[model samples]
Target: MTDKYSAGVLLFRRGDGGVEVLVGHMGGPYFARKDNGAWSIPKGEYEPELEDARAAASREFHEELGLFVPAGDWIPLGDVRYSSGKGKKNLIVWAVEGDLNPADVVPGTFEMEWPPRSGRMANFPEIDRADWFDLATAHDKLSTGQRPYLDRLNDYLTQTGE
Candidate 1:
């Protein structure tokens, strides 16, 4: 069977504290109040027929973060496949060096039936908050499946001597 796929951009920057990457706290009831494993890179699913992974990554970044990713050389981290409720999902990510104050992120919204059986729906930001975390801290905060992107970014940085 054909599995689903997703794409995302891992935006990082060097700061006095250390190398930091932006991660988002998922919204909606499911993730509310959760911390560890609750954060993820701004990303979303896209079909291969719709757009190439890179293009889909850029589009998903804009859609989830509510801002276009700043132009930069995107360092590919390749794909990682993980299981989801529906099936397996292949997440394609690229690391890009840039600066953005996560406090400034205006995440897009999604509507869902908040009370489970409630007959009403409510709108919630896709990401309730975004923050820049040092690599070590980010590792602890990121969802398990996406953690590899951090390792890939670090290895690339070391190789490039950045």
Candidate 2:
């Protein structure tokens, strides 16, 4: 029952290989060398009391990837509750049909103390890279807690035939 809240948009597109989703590899030393489970939806923490979840999602998409959210209908994929190193977290996400070139990404960055305790501050991109992956691959790449949204998105697409 943590008070922290986050929201994100999962942009999907129909490709020759079938459905593909845009995901970003988390940056910083902790995930620099990691592959599976090191990627995430473009998202950020937000105060639920001050902003709508959908708005937060769109804002985070731009802030994280530096690209405007493509125009499309947003299908709510619902929320998931899970425990993180920061404690329990509640994340709400939506699936939108869209496409974009990964090379166009200009990721946002954050400054933090690096080397654990050297009292040195370093800047790192929030998302080092962005790319599209099939559902199976995305499942392996996305963080465990965020994986449920992919299932939800699949169910929605199946139901709507979209």
Candidate 3:
């Protein structure tokens, strides 16, 4: 068994429709045709010994979405652990208040052998699409492993009376 750790930020904003969050669809062939559980928070795994959780969250947010999580008080949503095949992935998420237009996003890209067994390599955006969705929509769109962040963020905000 292996252990994986990731850090990311959940950028939320208030609007007439209530709170909204910026999320992205997982790119690549595996998730290409899937919609329900294909989207995820903007995050990436990092070596825990090399960086603090919050700092890693900020870094990964920028790396995945090509934009910084706007400067603000980031409320720690704590950790979530989920099974990934024979490994476990633990994710630390922070809820930060921010607003950004999805149209302006410039997602980071990764190179991979698109057609398995073929030698051809191609570049694809890590997140092929991004958009702002209200909590309910986010819950429906985000992957099961990442959906807890939505509830955690709601709890934090409610407890703090934000």
* lDDT (tens digit, per residue) of candidate 1 on 1-162: 679999999999997887999999999889998999999998999998878999999998998898889889999999999876688889999998898878778999999997998889999999999999999999999988999999999999999899
Alpha-carbon deviation at 141 in model 2, angstroms: 0.4
By TM-score, the best candidate is 2
> In candidate 1, which residue pairs get closer than 3 Å at backbone N, Cα or C atoms, i.e. clash?
none
Taking all chains together, each candidate's TM-score versus the true structure is 0.95, 0.97, 0.95
Residue 125, model 3: lDDT of 90
RMSD of each: 1.2, 1.0, 1.2
lDDT of 2 by residue, 28-123 (tens): 999999999999999889999899999999999999999999998989999898888888889999988988999999999999999899999999
Cα displacement (angstroms), candidate 2, residue 16, comes to 1.8
lDDT of 3 by residue, 10-109 (tens): 9999988888999999888888899988898999988889889888889888988889889889888889999765589999999889888888888999
Query: CA lDDT of 61 in candidate 3?
Result: 88
Query: Candidate 3 — worst ten consecutive residues by lDDT sum?
Result: 78-87
Model 1 off-target regions past 4 Å?
none
In candidate 2, which residue pairs get closer than 3 Å at backbone N, Cα or C atoms, i.e. clash? Answer: none
Error of 2 at 158 (Å): 0.7
Which model, 2 or 3, shows the larger TM-score? 2
Which candidate, 2 or 3, has the higher lDDT?
Answer: 2
